[model samples]
Target: MQFRPTLWPTLITIPALVVLVMFGWWQVQRLQWKTELIQELEIRGAGPAIPLLVDARISAEDLMFRRVTVTGHYMHEAEMHLLNRVRDGIPGINVFTPLVRANGGGALLVNRGWVPIDWPGTSIEDHDVEPVIVEVTGVVRIPDPPGWLTPGNEPEKNAWYFIDLAGMSAAAGVLPFTDYYVFATGEKNLAGEPVPWLAPDPNEWRVDLPNNHLTYAITWFSLAGVLFIIYVIYHTRRRGPDDG
Candidate 1:
């Protein structure tokens, strides 16, 4: 029971096979990159806190997971509430307030951390620090934009689902802020922690980040192997009338 595969079908498969292999290779590269990033986060997050120089030319990559101290006063008037955030099985939103640097620099957006969803019933000022001059020790974090499947931010409505510092700052008139935001690892001031709020800890977030690139790479390679087997079998199992 032999059937012949035409030359055209075999030729077409050549490019198709190459593309599949290329995809597998790309995923393999991503696996290595993700592994190194995960390792760096664990190592840096455990180190002692350092003074953050907002005026310095530090790249976000250099600042990831590193603990730093920020001295500034909260700008309660321009706070942004990041919706769709939850902690410890409780639903709530995280508060992001702009900070005016004490050392005579531009403002920075500090993720002071989460609070109850009903916070609007009261006022963000209620969580504000008493002394204008306050010190916050936290981990440096680069905010991730809304995911592809996530809804887009509505800047005009002041409703946000994820962190987009540039848009949020500009809309609230808090521009010229830091490119990266700080995840408050400790209490923002002497006022103590906010009620029903959980501070953003990098260690907890790191544990949940997915690292399945290696698995995806193997899947692509396996598909390529299956395709190759079909191609070889089709060409081998062929007979002509002369064989009859």
Candidate 2:
């Protein structure tokens, strides 16, 4: 079989093929990186809780999802609410309060847990007349960057769609706050008593990291294959008429 390729088709097809293949390869690399991250997080979650060093310079990757103990007094006046959180098909918000470390380390935001949207008090002070100093065990959490579609947080109104450490700190007047926050472990407070809100069990609260790179990679490669087949057929038909 004679293969006569036209100049126009060859030029167009070669660059298009190169671009498609490159995209597919990049997705494969992303798949591997994501898999390793999930595995490391699981191992950290299973270990014993360690004391959080407020002054220590820890990378976000190293601190994320690690169970740690922090002793502090809850700053009820500085509490903030994260909107649009749901549990058991009910809409609610996650309550975040700054914990002023007992050791004078620094103020660390603590995600106390989820509360009903209609829950009367925005801060713990509304419920407790006096402040309480306690030690709590919880899981460290790093805030994810807001997506393009996510609405901007309103600090003046105390409305939050996502976690913004810097913004929250400034709004609450708690400067020099820790970069990461902690999710309290049980539905009850440190005293083993029931609280108004629900807390997540760190052991059961597995990370829901999405991994769709494999599917994306297949689509790009398929498109490249289809393009190659069309190019060959077009050239072959043109040669057939000349031969006859």
Candidate 3:
């Protein structure tokens, strides 16, 4: 009777091979997702802006991120500055004010634009610039999720940057607003103080799929091949002497 210990190299190699295959598969899946997302954004960007609320009717209201146009009166009373935004390398504030539809019915919060950080507790003087009815065109986008580090809309304390649509509506004594608001793109009213009309830059959104999976797959398969070759050589050389 004879007993022999299993070769530790082959035993460890099996698990390493399995892990490499799984990692490669995961990266392939990620590449596919990125490709699909880029295609969708391109398609959406090509369409014409929806002009009226009725024209863009649909389920689930946060149409933020979609290009849209609306005319309304700027509700100066409900205006608040979203804190801690940066512009040109300086700490700044984002101005957000409610826009009451000119024809009446509902109000939408407009993210006017960013302003350089001012005194810690001072509000931007609205009267310094008179209110004027204006037309705004821009893409709709949902507010950043709570706890995303953007200043939350706080009317009572007069501090805010992120436009929490639902919260803004509640604070304005208007229940329920569109789940999203327009990022004003052109023809902003009352310019200078509160610069509006900013389109989101998409450089960061481009898909950059990596080809490392093939490299990894090759590495694993190569190692497996080397192991098999060594095993054969070792057994063949040893058995040659045994055969004699």
Candidate 4:
């Protein structure tokens, strides 16, 4: 007929406290990261495209949709057709080619853009445009494999889209290229492939991490209040009338 504070509350309350604290901490970290990203974008978003090999390094995580300049040759044999890609609302393959940099010691994988899947079951002939080096300007982007979910990159099947930089480098025999790739920004190359490079427009960037821990904290504190009220009412009702 009476409620007691015992091991059950300890077990449940302790774990809940731990989880609430950890969740709040994680949200704080996310809020901080989002703030820093916004500030950085404000300062650097207006700059011209950066060279892939520039002294100022940019990580793929941060550079997606950012404009960048790169120079390299198309490794046509290594062109991979990423399944289920689309352009202008048509299903297609996303073509990825290795760019042997003009700087002469490294290569960078470049996304040539999407092409219709009408060429299904047929391998497109490889063509060399120019042995001479040329520059490409485009936005930096993360790999978007064709499927909403893709199996792993299969070099043997020649299927790919998600840029697993390490895996791609190894499979393409690029033995030591940088760990990221760029989307070529322009008309198709001389080989008649489409080259669509997008810039980091404001409409393209999204920053949507909110801190609701304060609200959550209030909810939790309210629970604590309800528990206290229930405890007080139960003891008052159970106490003998004359007991002091």
Q: Whose lDDT is greatest here? A: 2
Query: lDDT values of the candidates?
Result: 0.74, 0.78, 0.60, 0.60
Per the 3 Å backbone cut-off, how many clashing residue pairs does candidate 2 have? Answer: 0
| Backbone clash count, each prediction separately | 0, 0, 7, 1
lDDT of 1 by residue, 176-241 (tens): 667788887674554454432334432233423579999999998998999988987877764667
TM per candidate: 0.79, 0.85, 0.61, 0.62
Question: Given candidate 4, what's the lDDT at residue 143?
Answer: 53
lDDT of 3 by residue, 34-76 (tens): 5676566555545577764733466333343456778777766
TM accuracy, model 3: 0.61
Off by over 4 Å in 3: 1-20, 52-64, 103-105, 119-132, 147-155, 188-244
TM-score pick, better of 2 and 4? 2
TM-score comparison, 1 vs 4, better candidate: 1
Task: Give the clashing residue pairs of candidate 3, or none.
Answer: 64-140, 64-141, 65-140, 65-141, 82-160, 82-161, 184-197
Where does candidate 1 stray beyond 4 Å? 1-6, 119-122, 125-130, 152-158, 188-210, 238-244
Looking at candidate 4, the ten consecutive residues that score lowest on lDDT are 196-205
Off-target runs (Cα >4 Å) in candidate 2 are: 121-125, 187-204, 238-244
TM-score, structure 4 vs. true: 0.62
For candidate 4, write residues 1-244 as lDDT tens digits: 3445566655666666666566656666665776777666544444688766643355666676567777656676666666766656877776777778766747787766666677542253535333434577766655544457666667788877566777777888877556556766542244454432211111222333344555655665566556556544644445466645
